[model samples]
Target chain A: MSTPVLDVQGLAFAYPDGHQALYGVNLHVHRGERVALLGPNGAGKTTLVLHLNGILDAGAGSVAVSGLPVTKDNLREIRRRVGIVFQDPDDQLFMPTVRDDVAFGPANLGIRGGELEKRVMEALDKVGMADYADRPPHHLSFGQRRRVAVATVLVMEPEILVLDEPSSNLDPASRRELAEILTGLDVTLLMVTHDLPYAFELCPRSVVLSDGVVVADGPTYDVLTDDALMAAHRLELPFGFDPRAIGRR
Target chain B: MGQGHGHKLHFHGHSPVHRAAPHHKLLALLGFTLVVVATPKDWFAAYGLYLLLLAAVVVVSTVPPTYLLKRLVVEVPFVVFALLMPFIATGPRVEVLGVSLSEHGLLAGWALLAKGTLGVLASLTLAATTEPRDLLLGLERLRLPQQLVQIMGFMIRYVDVVGDEMRRMRIARESRGFTARNPKHWPVVARSAGALFIRSYERGERVHLAMVSRGYTGSLRQGSDR
Candidate 1:
């Protein structure tokens, strides 16, 4: 009903070597909606996500965040609105300490002094990483690093929190904790993942991309249960993950 | 990633030296080193004074004496070089214990050993008191080249990541019965190094894109997140 927070239309892209990564892909994410962009490796999921914040320009079409067209002129604004949590927490939390990593985005945007400190603390607190603020990121466990990565983006106060393969390397407990943190946030979410169970658990809507195009789009449970569609896209749920039996937590 | 924080020289504590601003301590250390270097070699008492000054700092900082001794291992090569000087130089000879040695050589070696040891100890003390990140920040504040500082920052941040990758590769190699005990096994090590380089490069690209997405427009602003 509300204006979409993210709008991508006919987006197509190809690397310089002529490998087409995305082909006329279209997607829309409404305000506060959590959508999982599910696909196999090299299925252009990352390329599509890159296009969301203008990191990779649309080769043929357009991507607009909060109705602002993603272009050189609007890039700063668009980036401010779309916070991307990269796949590697090491990459995302490049700053020395957890607090600095959390403050990096907002500080780059010129937030300073008490307000900057407050944002850093609040972001760390949101991820339950306040106690680790002063610690070097390398000192933390992998799961802790991932949580700090999430806080790094959260400090920017972006409308849409885009996560890349968030559940890939986490232990079960960390995975559950991360899910709880993510679900508690009141923002639009676009998670790119190959983790079928993670997609089903976190996102109500799912868009399946295959060979650079959307092959399926609907409720996650429905898309996941469609065996032929899942097979066609090379999506496989774990042997015991039956979508029909698990109620939304 | 599996290892400890792993900064061997840095001993974390809340002593006055540890609490001092990094740039201030960096400046102080530089000034002290200059004073030591400028002191004439014949001024043995001045050297003793310098040693006493350093000892005072060490005592005040509460850095364990044994810790400093452990860190001194890094200066072993220099010590060896200095030791060679007393035997190798050609000059007027002197006999102390019936072994003839050059008087100039002896003085030169003494000066080198004293100055070098003092300098290394001062450095170790500075390192012990300051966090590595703060040291980088101190360098940036002291007008070190921005590009060099950025490179250093990236190296400090990702050294562990690269180390972890290498560990994984090594495990993967060893699990497959690749025992690198001889020269013939070097090719495998070299290949793994090459692979690590390529992986690191790709990861660099990904990190850059991640930075771009979060509005990193070239220059990095020092965050007041402390």
Candidate 2:
């Protein structure tokens, strides 16, 4: 890919309590590529994902999205290029109504009048939530809330989609729908997930993190199906699932 | 989250008062308060007129009298406090109901009761008709502090979240050996409260981060996109 869409080099973070969540993490994501970050809990996958949108600043190095360095001055531009869906849809959808939440991002971008309304409608349509534009977030089912959360981010028209545990609480049918939706999108995808089958089915490439460091980076099938590596790093594939056949989609 | 049991400040339904322009209803409430207070202590005719107006507005709003009366219970403390004004005040004595009471204090108490009830009913009727958001919008439009209204809007939205969280925490504590039987163990409950505060603070930080990522500048938008 000509000039990676996202570039992270030696990024590190330390909480005030002196806990190092990320340590010199370096990764590159190409334009329009769907990649998954697979690791056990506390692997710093979420910390890495937060860096993509400048939610948590990197201490050791830098993160650049769309060739723009992520910084306070350039946050608007960087955020416009990186759409992140949090692990909890409850945290993501906070507005009284779905339409307001979907409109929230576009409004922040200073999009006003009819163009903004059009953007909100188009976004709801993208996630198949047109009928629920006025429904309150709390009234929605978990699956529907997830879709509304997607709409909330999509309205910004971000180039890269970074999701943390998108399939964490979704049913099988919702997962299938999410897979289809992700597959149809031409934008870049960086998903942090512990769901092995989910990661394999949705992502072409995979990266593994363990003990605050990158342990494996390669094709999804190679990284996910390696029994020895899986055991060593606390990763596993579900019974009777073949990663090779997953790519047929 | 289920069955909508806790929302007190919500639009009752479609009604002329509910459909009235937010600005108009806001002005009317202000005017009503002004008129109600301007009336003298013994202008029973005017006081009666004001009460009639309140009833009319309540009926127009379609909010049940029971709902309004139920909420009006919030003023009982104030009413009781007003009821004490005549008894406690040292003034010209009068014999009534076999007990001497202050005549001046009684008139003052009547004024207090009249104004307070009218003021409260005006507010209750307004709240019943207009949603909290529209009321804030009305306040903003009426030149109230934008920062304050924005803060109120956010607080109204998230206060429920905070309550839900507290409820869940209380449930968890009850499940895990928490009890009020021992007054000395109250410190345990206090510690849980502190933990809840920390969790809420952390959640706020996370929410702010999410808002920044989504490009939230300062205000909450409803009508126009920006």
Candidate 3:
């Protein structure tokens, strides 16, 4: 695999109120590898994701996206290389119009003129939202709005796309569409999700977190099949539904 | 989830007024109001002509006359104020229907009505023709502060979401044995409002974090898919 695009070492973070979220988490993502971070609530999945993109400052240790360290000075460059999608589509899709929301990141990055406009269209097209450019965010369905949120980040064309619960609230069709879209993208992905089937489908590697620590990381099939570890972390497969059999072609 | 996206109640149609640029519409509307406001008490002819101009615009735009009049009823609460104006002032008596009333007061009431109607029509036409996004853009072009525009843009985008959330909260409270009949339940209503505010604040923080991950700096911009 290409040299690790994202490098992290012993990352830790605590809210000012003293609630520790991430506990010395050590993880890395290589180019073109789709990795899933699976854990129950309060597992610090979002906190770790925020650190990857430098959204929140780490209390300890280090994080680097595409070799750029997450810091005040390198934040802009790090952000450009790592696009993170929040769990809630409502939170992400905040512009008056879909076109505006998608163009927001690119425009902020200083892209302008015909080139900027082209990027905006291409980004919307990436998420199958070309026809929704004129529609306001509030006017779209939940599934459609979720796709627009993805487009908003895709416009940046980051090297590593980090998603917090991409499939969380989506319906079956939307979930399938999300899987299809994520699978087709040729970039590094570190998605934080609790859906075992979704993780098995999109990612070949699975990383388990519990109490803010990475307890297990390995091939998706092997890690998911470990029932003892899954039980400890509250991860489970639905009745009679198997991940390995359904995940692969 | 309004599948029937009752697409905001704007008076939209293919009329000269509707087709005009939002910038021009805003200017014309504001100027018309300013003229009415600045007019002398006896300047009813100018005010009448301006009202006529507004009516002509309304006809040019295909917005339902009833809808236009209905929206104009926001001034209903001011009826008492208007009624008292003529009698409160000391001026030449203008008694027609066997009642003493100030002529100045009558002129003032007419001027207020004419100006208010004209202003509302101008805004209605602008809103009917141009979407909110376009209106914000027009404002930006007019050199309104960027911060103000950004705030307004987000407000417009999320108002419906927040409104829906509020509605759901009310429903939830009602389902749990709360009702408007109890005077003692006022605190519960206030608490819900406070809770809603907290939820909104947290939601804003999460949303901001999401934006930063997607490469947002402080600047806000929209795509040109159109």
Candidate 4:
């Protein structure tokens, strides 16, 4: 109601080869709210996420973060506000040591010396990866690397934390741990996921994107319970995993 | 992928050499190699002294002699070239052990072996003591171009990722009962290589996007991020 943290209005995008990824789409996420962007493969989920950070310019509409439009001039401030945790941890953690990787974003902002160190450690501490500050990312376990990836973004203190497939390769325990971490965070969250159970547990609100359009936007419980909508959009819950039986957390 | 402590060439140690600043060691390595290269080939005594100096450093560095010796296998091709120098090189002849050999050729061959061995040994000692990251930082401190440093940093970071991807591709190929047993299978291997290149290129683009999303402009700031 009072200036949503992320405002996407009529956002649309198409690849260079004439493949239209997103049609006109409108969504708004308020401060401190967690929202899941749910869609099947090629439903323009990634296209929408890219737009949020100005990685891909909008074909038709505009995306603004916390009232600041994502444009060339506002890119630095916009990037600072919108932190995207990519699906593959390997893609995000590109520095030699965990400390360096975590410090990369802040360092880019000209943060130096003790301030940078403190920020890096604080982020690592939040993810319980404080001990691995000096360790090479390649030496870390897959889940640990994922946690480190989150720290790399968290160090920036973004307003809206955009996670792309956060639970894709995580084991059950890792998934639960990440959920705990994500739930504890105090930032607006936009999770792009096909993990229905995860969405039900983490995000209070869910938006279903089908054919580059928002087909459904409602409470997570309502979205998951709509059998016809789920069937039509190819959104399937795991066998015997009933949302009504377990209910929302 | 499960490399625990240090890089393959690095021996985890806490000796004075390991504690020494990386750029200093880099300069020392350069100085030592230059001195060795500049010495006259006939100066056999000077060569021995250089070896002694290298041996002392190796001892001080606490890297085992056998470790250095084991890695010297990389110089085998050079060693073979040095060994053939006396036979093919034309020079004044001298008989030793009933075999005639060119005197200049023998000296040239000796110099090549001595210089090559000393250089290789010194480099191995440096590598054995210093971590790869430290060495790169040392290069940065030595005023290497920032872009080149960043490229090297990224290469070090993603080499394993690319390697793992290749390994997975190989496994996928093997699972499908494909093997490059002969020249007939070269095309398959070439195609796989092409696929890897394209995948790596796409990954590079994604990594660039990720960097952009995190506020990376044209150049990374020179700070503690190194």
What is every candidate's C-alpha DockQ against the true complex, given to 2 decimals? Answer: 0.61, 0.45, 0.58, 0.59
* Candidate 3: pairs in clash: A99-B223, A100-B222, A100-B223
**What is the C-alpha lDDT profile of model 2 across B122-165, one tens digit per residue?**
88888888877677677777878767876786676677777778
As for TM-score, the candidate ahead, 2 or 4, is: 4
Top lDDT prediction, candidate number: 4
Each candidate's clash count: 0, 0, 3, 0
lDDT of each: 0.89, 0.83, 0.80, 0.90
Q: Number of the top candidate by TM-score?
A: 4
Candidate 2 achieves a global lDDT of: 0.83
Docking quality band of candidate 4, CAPRI definitions: medium
Model 1 lDDT tens row, A1-249: 776899899999999899999989989999989999998889999888888888887889999888899998988889989999988887777877788777778877888788989988999999999999888888899899999999888889998999999998999999999999999998899999988898988999999999999998999988988999998878998988888788544
Provide TM-scores for the models: 0.93, 0.89, 0.92, 0.95
Over the stretch B1-226, how does candidate 4's per-residue lDDT look in tens digits? 4444456799989999999999999999999999999998888899889999999998998899999999999999988988888788896988889988888888888888999999999999999999878888888899988899888888877887888789999999999999889999999999999999999999999899889888887775333453
Q: For residues A72-127, write the lDDT of model 2, one tens digit per residue.
A: 99988888999998877777777767888888888888888889889999988888
Q: Which DockQ-derived CAPRI band holds candidate 3? A: medium
**In model 1, what is the error at residue B127, expressed in angstroms?**
0.8
The residue-by-residue lDDT of candidate 3 on A1-42, one tens digit each, is 555798889999999999999889999888889999999998
- Candidate 2: residue B189 lDDT (0-100): 77
- In candidate 4, residue B141 scores what lDDT? 91
True lDDT of residue A51, candidate 3:
83
Task: Give a tens-digit lDDT track for model 4, residues A193-231.
Answer: 999999999999999999999999999999999999999
**TM-score of only chain B in every candidate structure:** 0.87, 0.84, 0.84, 0.87
